[model samples]
Target: MSIWWSLHLRREAASVPLARRLLLGTMETAGVDPDVSYDLSVALGEACANAVEHGGGASRGGSSEAYRVTAYLDGEKCRIEVADSGPGFARAHAPRPPRVDAEHGRGLFLIRELADHVHIGDKPGRGGTVVSFDKMLKWTKDPSLLTA
Candidate 1:
């Protein structure tokens, strides 16, 4: 079975957990392994938080008041994408690892560590960042719903 959903959320702190909860609930209902679900939820939260923080400013060319989160569960794999409307990654380089003593700049790195594959880039024909990641799903011993 396959499932997908998308949310256009305000760029606010509260929206982070709301997106995380929905992803968690969906994974739980689909009988995903709890550990896997937790990892994905954490990654989702980080992505959402990043969008809320860096997703808005002087509009480069897109909507500045909201961002988007999309999730896809297909067979043995699950993918998630978080997109925002802010100045794109004009830095022209990958995110550098944060310092151990630093309090920030770890979100992208955390997502890369948790997910099997990650893509961070500018949205096509737009001024924003798009962070996409996917992981191999693990099912519970006895799946209650969708199973691979």
Candidate 2:
């Protein structure tokens, strides 16, 4: 069996934890390995935090003050995507690594570290940022859902 969910969340600091908790709970209920669940949850939190902090622009004129998070658990892999209505990345420039002492720019880097695959790019047609990642899941000895 496969499980998936999507949330349209307000871009508030409080919303970050809500999304994290939901992901954690879903992974737990599905009997995903605790360590794997934790790593993905942390990555999810970072993406959500970025959305809250940089996912909007007043100059965009009535851009929605919300973002979207979508998660899919299929077979032995899980994928998560977070998208926001902010100024999209420049077509000519890719994300660069932050300096060692930099506090801010580490979220995307950290997400890449935790997940098996990561994609960061502009939303198609609409102007926004999208960060999506996938991880190979490890299941507990006893799982609530049957493995494929």
Worst 10 residues of 1 by lDDT: 139-148
Candidate 2 Cα deviation (angstroms), residue 116: 0.5
What TM-score does each of the candidates earn? 0.92, 0.90
User: Model 2, stretches more than 4 Å misplaced?
Assistant: 58-63, 144-148
Tens-digit per-residue lDDT, 1-148, candidate 2: 5999999999999999999999998998899999999999999999999999989855354555989999999989999999998888676866689999998989989999999999999887667899999999998987665553
Report the alpha-carbon TM-score of model 2 versus the true structure: 0.90
lDDT of 1 by residue, 34-125 (tens): 99999999999999999999888577444798999999999999999999987876666766899999899999899989999999888876
What TM-score, to 2 decimals, does candidate 1 have? 0.92
Segments of candidate 1 deviating more than 4 angstroms: 60-62, 91-93, 146-148
Candidate 2 backbone collisions, by pair: none
